[model samples]
Target: MQDMKIADLPVHDRAIDITGETCPMTFVRTRLALDSLPDGAVLLVRLKGADPRANVPRAAADQGHDLLDMFDLDDGSAILVIRKAGA
Candidate 1:
């Protein structure tokens, strides 16, 4: 997989929408997807609720990939853009 350029990142990828899910489940699914990807792959995660938004990054940070960016959509939902680090 290719590392998405910063500008093109927000435009693409098959997103995982984990809305209506809480805390660990959100992180769990994200981790599972990330774990299976090769370095440079990107995962776009849409999560609801504050804890998942806040806590997921902390958990992801520990995994070595930088949480490249996050944006809150107008509908009170958030999108997290994560990129795998180091080949």
Candidate 2:
């Protein structure tokens, strides 16, 4: 991705709202979507519960994307914004 801080990321180009989606499937779908984005593209992921919150970011990071930000929303779900890396 570009040489920018997580907060410096521009508006998200895409969003994967997996609020009601279950475990492994959560990250699975996330990975699939991320793979489809172009370099430096930003994605906002809306998810619920602890498992997805804990695992998806780590997994995405491990896959070489940047976990720009992650925080809880008022409805008990959370939003994780990541900027895609590489070609």
RMSD of each: 6.0, 6.6
In Å, residue 27's CA in model 1 sits off its true spot by: 0.3
What tens-digit string does per-residue lDDT give for candidate 2 at 1-87?
A: 234344753488888889889999999989888888899888989899889999999999998999988876667887799988884
Tell me the spans in candidate 1 whose CA falls farther than 4 Å from its real position.
Answer: 1-13
lDDT of each: 0.79, 0.85
TM-score of each model, paired residue for residue: 0.80, 0.85
TM accuracy, model 1: 0.80
What's the true lDDT of residue 35 in model 1? 79
**Which one wins on TM-score?**
2
- In terms of TM-score, how similar is model 2 to the real structure? 0.85
Candidate 1, 18-83: lDDT as tens digits:
887787899999888887777888788888787987888889989788888897766777789998
